[model samples]
Target: MSLANKPNRKLIATLAALLFAGSAAAFNLDSNVPITVNADNARLDDGKGIATYTGDVVMTQGETELTADRVVLYRDETGLQRIEASGQPAHYRQAATEGQGKTDAKALNITYSAPESLLTFEKEAVIEQNGNLFRGDIIHYDSVQRVVTAEGAANDNNGSGRVEMVIQPRSRQNTQDPDGSSQGQ
Candidate 1:
């Protein structure tokens, strides 16, 4: 939809929820914030309950944001069903709950299915949160169950064919000793 004039609030709200819900520590109020989308071009087919935005597309709700070269949104009678975004590397970011900092992700393609509460990243997928990192050819996050699965490239001789993760150690300053003083202190 040319949302330049009449924006679809329902669609936007549904999208905001689906996008941010994947983050386990997403800011609680993000879903209640108004969403804004900007793109060079947009096409909406109400009959199919589909909308497509091309060029540099940026969507934001509160501290959560997504940017890509193209984005497609699909909805059914119930609500938004799925979202697909593609770019050289589509990017997503959202504030984490309280002091956890932010979660950031990037991939060549990203897809989210509302009913399944699943978020998938494909092609050079990478996600970083709280200084921890996960990288693979594909990654899936189950928001409801708070589980993550990743797959590396196939046994192609040219590729490493292994998923990679870097889990940073918790800072000593945040850990308390048995005596109730900070570990570092």
Candidate 2:
């Protein structure tokens, strides 16, 4: 699937898994992940259902893994949210394993609004897709929209990454996408 395409089925269904399964990886249909984490300290806020894990944290969820000094999670009114994340140089991956594909990022500071699925990384942000990478001062991603945005100038250095800021159309907006369900195969 093209990350730049605004296909509807890919986005809304992310919520289906999170609401039913205990793990996000379990909820994802196209991906399966087995991840582990090592945190020096951890805390959870009861009323808000927010958790803060810190100290050389290494967490893996399916094919996605992140290593940072800290990771904060919470549930906003809309859905799961990442409060904040910071480390010496936090590393993250999506669709990364031995052979499948790789989308990785590194940042000094990371902030996310979970409900809106907005992730913003600052201070030397670098993201990779396949063997290529994009580097910038800041990078932001919206999961619901499946859009990745970068600021302060960056390049698709390896020629493997796409430089366009994708604007994914939601299902409600994609009356033009042809799934072929209406026609015989």
Candidate 3:
């Protein structure tokens, strides 16, 4: 089934699994649902592909959501980039993405690189992939591109300035061996 319909608590489980499959070993993260964004006065620059949301701004992607006083997102010749978020009680959330088809995750500050497909969660970053969840000061996720490296970052809680993330496992051994490890046919 498509990630949007994985029947998991973490809506992003399917998408995260599909996106992070190749980098599962490198990241070793859990399934972090999605996030939602809310902004008071939002200004969109379609030509530049930039969206500036200010005044009690809130952004949610997959299971992770963030609430800040102001948020500025801009894209230029370089690529998609985001500025820092400011707020008293910056909020975040995450959820499961797979495993037993259940998900529950959350996050706070989220910085992402659109072109590179890299995202980072810091300051009270929490993650829930499959049936497991972990909370840290920071979480980072890099989405590898066919020609570019995944250079991105983010933050969830109210930590100093760290990043973190959760990922889903999509790889499987060809067969189970007698030694306990999987053996390929």
TM-score for all models, in order of appearance: 0.75, 0.57, 0.42
Order the candidates by TM-score, highest first: 1, 2, 3
Candidate 1, run of 10 with poorest lDDT: 12-21
The digit string of per-residue lDDT tens for model 3 on 107-165 reads 45656555445655554555443323445555555545311112123433344343223
Top TM-score model: 1
Q: What is the lDDT of candidate 2?
A: 0.56
Task: Please give, for residues 1-185, the per-residue lDDT of candidate 1 as tens digits.
Answer: 67662544454334333333335532222256666779999999999999999999998778778899999989898867788999999997776543455678999999888778788989999887655677889988766665677778996886698877765455732353433233443
TM-score of 2: 0.57
Q: How many residue-pair clashes does candidate 1 contain?
A: 0
Q: Residue 145 of model 2: what lDDT?
A: 56
- Kindly report which residue pairs in candidate 2 clash with one another: 6-169, 33-62, 34-62, 35-60, 81-114
- Residue-level lDDT of model 2, residues 3-69, one tens digit each, is 6655543442442222112212211323344336679999878688788899998776665577899
Order the numbered candidates by lDDT, best leading: 1, 2, 3
Error of 2 at 62 (Å): 1.2
**For model 2, what is the error of residue 130's alpha carbon versus the real structure, in angstroms, after optimal superposition?**
2.3
Q: Regarding TM-score, does 2 or 3 come out ahead?
A: 2
Model 3 misplaced regions, further than 4 Å: 1-38, 43-50, 56-69, 77-79, 83-108, 144-185
